[model samples]
Structure formats: structure tokens, C-alpha cells
Target: MENKIHFQYLIDGDDFTRAGEASSDIKSKLKMMNINPDAVRRVAIAMYEGEINMIIHADGGTIDVDVYPDKLTMVLKDTGPGIPDIDKAMEEGYSTAPDNIVSLGFGAGMGLPNMKRASDEMEISSVVGQGTTVTMTVLF
Candidate 1:
């Protein structure tokens, strides 16, 4: 484990207040570790998007983060109603968020797109009635 740090967080469904907690914590840690500011910003944005998705769509889930000298990786997993169409979901402004969520000023359909744009690489796996797992990485 040469210069590697790992962390795990549990997200509460419908908890808009806590949606960005994990990402904020990670950002603080990264800054304390003297990580590149650009990389830290990317990680925070991507992770925060994932957290918001879990709260709105997945009804809660877990996020795992691994930080290393050369890169950082994040894995977000949720057991909520899985995505039926990944390709369509990838399209910007294509969101399945409920009306109530939209009313709260969230779920603008940009979560996944922003996450992908912030990360060096991203992968998503989902099962219709099972769950969704998103993995993202940013290189320093």
C-alpha cells in the first residue's frame, strides 16, 4: 500500500442535506495531502454527482474511494431500481428523476455527464431491477 488511502461512505436516500458530505470530506483530505488542485476539484465534482444520484435515484448506497500518488478512484454502488437504458442515460439532460426531485432544484440530468467529464475514465454497470455501480478515476 505505497502511498494509498482508502475511505468508504454510506449515503442516505432522500437526504439532500448530506448529499455532498463524502465529496466534501474527500476534497478536504486531498487538499491537506497537497494533491494537485485541479485533480482535487475533479474528484470532488465527480463524487458529489455520484452522491446526489444515489440520494435521488438509488435511494441510498455506498461510495468507496481510493487515493494514490498517481491517481484516485471512486466506486459508487446503489441497490435501487437500476437503469434500464445506459446509453440514453448517458445523454446530457436525459434524467429519470421524479417531479418532486426536480421541484427541489436537482436532477437536471447532468450528473452522469458531469461525472464523466470530470474523471479521466468512467464505467457504469446496472441491472434493471437490481442496482447500479459506477466507477470513476482521475489521474494526477
Candidate 2:
């Protein structure tokens, strides 16, 4: 079996019912590969959060995942309005989601903070009008 694997998934912006499918698939694959439960949980949670963020804020996006013997990497790219303040965005309770979004059970504003806490390292590149890309790595 290969010690490394790379996978990419497209997040459909219009499908609220299918938001976490990619993360679920990855979790299943990691389990079949015998990855630790804790590791799989972290990956799933962080990636799921990113996916929801893309759906809620970006209008849709892409997720790339690299699985290695000792680390896992995820990159989420979106085309929606980019974050104006990364610093504020990182704060646990700071969120700009609309009331409509909150009514749907998301937008608690814990996406970035939770992703950072779940991964070993995280980087964000965003432009106000261009887009946002988040790269996160978890060490095994």
C-alpha cells in the first residue's frame, strides 16, 4: 500500500444537504487504511468545518487533501467574498454570517478557531475581492 495519497473534492455551493459528504468519504477511507481514530476525527472535523465555511461564505469551493505517513494536509479554496479581517475572523465568537445562515444551524464563528486547534499549523491567503484559500496541516 502507498504511504501517501492525495485527494481533491469540489464543494457544491447550492447543496446544503450534501455539505459534509467529502469529509465523510475521507474519514471512511482513513478508517479503512487503519488510521488512528483520533486522527481521523480531527481531519473530519476540521475539513467539515472548512467545507461548511465554503458553502456558507464562499458560495462553493474546492478541498485538496494529502495523506502521509506522519502528516495530513488540507487546502480549501473558495471564490466568495474574501474575509476582510483575518484577525477578527480567527476570534471564536466573531462572525459575519447573515441571519439566514444562522437560522440554518451554522455560523457559530468557530470554524477558523476550531480548524487551528485541530491542526498543527494553518495558513490563510485571502483578498477582499478575489477569494480565500486556507491551508492546514496535521502532524501524525
Candidate 3:
């Protein structure tokens, strides 16, 4: 594609049923565009992890994706009670989700770790009481 394509999605917090919609949609779109399958899979996984985090932690959030010929970029922004410790949050099996969330089969503390693993490049920014934004990119 010569021009960049953009998409925006609104995530509803605590809504497990629709948590993966955005990622699914993006996957389909990428496939339709004949993008690389591996890149699409990586983007889907990273985006899905971010969406789940927005639902379990932040009340809700917005995700913006930009598709380019050689790369895909995803921006997940949430207004939740921002992460207290970035280093700790990045650790595998480290999660702050409550017991109730755990029972639902989520909040396994693998969200961020998985996201990082799937994306080629990732960056996170947060303010203690305000919110957080995670930006991830996958190169094709």
C-alpha cells in the first residue's frame, strides 16, 4: 500500500466478551490486504494483550493503529490508575489484577510480557494517578 491506513477502536472496560474484537478485526483487515501472516499474528497478539489489560485494569481505553507498507504501529491508551512500578509490571508472572479477575482466566501477568514478545519494538509511558499508553510496532 502506498498510503498509510488508520483505524481507531474503543475498548469497554470489564467487558470480557468484546475484549479481543479489535485485534480480530485488525487481523482480518491485514489478511485482506495480503500482508505477511507472521506480522499479522504478531500484531494480533500484541494488540489483544493490550486490549485485555485495558479491560481488566483501566475502565476502558482507545486503540489507534496505523498500517504502512513495511510496518504496523499500535497505540493503546488507558486512563486507569497507572502502573505503580514499570519494572515490576514488566516481569513475567507479575500482575496486580484482583482475585475476581484471576477467576476469569485473565490477569495471569502475561499480558505485558506477551505483548513485548510479540512486538518488534514496544514502549510504555504512564503517570502514577493518571493513565498509561503503550506503543508497539511490528515490522513486516
Candidate 4:
């Protein structure tokens, strides 16, 4: 069997203080495993973006990470309002975040863009009034 390490995290959407905690933990683990710094950085950035999106858009969600010898995979899922237009959402600086969220120094509309840039591969799937799921991978 292929060697792999897996982790799952439950994001608390209502708690801004806990935001990025999951990503931070994963970063540390990757570093400890002697993963390349570039790959670790990419994973951290992508995963952090996903976490913030879940907190800002979805009420709460789950993140799953799988670490393999050659790459890292991250999946984020939330049952909040789904993206109405994936194309528009993919555009930089286009955000549906409310004023209050923007006031908190988030919702700058860079989350998805940044996540995509950081990961080697990224995919998004959503259902209106249901939720959104994002999968990202970074090659080591």
C-alpha cells in the first residue's frame, strides 16, 4: 500500500479567532515531515484561504488533508449558501461577502484566487442553497 498521512478538521465558522488553526497545524506537520519548503508554503496558503472562505461564507465546514510522498491534497466542504456563479466568483476582487465581514478585514475577494494560485491543481463544486466543496493539491 502507498504511504500516506490523513487529517480531518472541523471548522468553527463563528469563531474568527480560531481561523487558520487547521492550516497552521498542517504546516507544522509538513515541515516536521521534511517536505519541501515550497510545497509546504503552497499548502499552507491554499488551505488557509479555504479555511477563511468557509468561515466567511459557509456557517461552518470540514477540511480533509492527505499527505503523500509526492503531493498533498486538501478538500474543504461547507453546507452554507453555494456559489451562484462559479465564473464570477473565480474572478479576482469579486466578492459576495457582506459589509460586516468586509469590515472585519476579510472578504477582500482574494480567497479563491489565492487558493488557486497556490495549489498545483484546484477544483470546485457547489449546489445552490446547499453548499460548496473545494479540492486542492500541491505537488512536493
| Model 1, runs deviating above 4 Å | none
Q: Can you give the lDDT of residue 83 in candidate 2?
A: 93
RMSD of each candidate relative to the true structure = 1.0, 1.7, 1.4, 0.9
Residue-level lDDT tens digits of model 3 in 1-140: 56799999999996788889999999999999999899999999999989989999899899999999999999999999999999899999998998888898888899999999999999999998899999999999
Per-model TM-score versus the true fold: 0.96, 0.95, 0.96, 0.97
Candidate 4 per-residue lDDT, tens place, 47-96, comes to: 99899899988987999999999999999999999999999999999999
Error of 3 at 66 (Å): 0.2
The local distance difference test score of each candidate is 0.93, 0.91, 0.94, 0.93
Candidate 1, residue 140: the lDDT equals: 83
Ten-residue region with minimum lDDT total, candidate 3: 99-108
Q: Residue 28, candidate 1: how far off, in angstroms?
A: 0.2
Pairs that collide in candidate 2 are: none
Q: In angstroms, how far off is 11's CA in candidate 4? A: 0.3
Candidate 2 lDDT, 65-137, residue by residue in tens: 9999888999999988999999999999889988788888888888899999988899999999889999998
Q: Show model 3 residue runs off by greater than 4 Å.
A: none
| Reference-based lDDT, residue 109, model 1 | 91
Q: Lowest-scoring 10 consecutive residues by lDDT in candidate 1? A: 10-19
lDDT of candidate 2?
Answer: 0.91
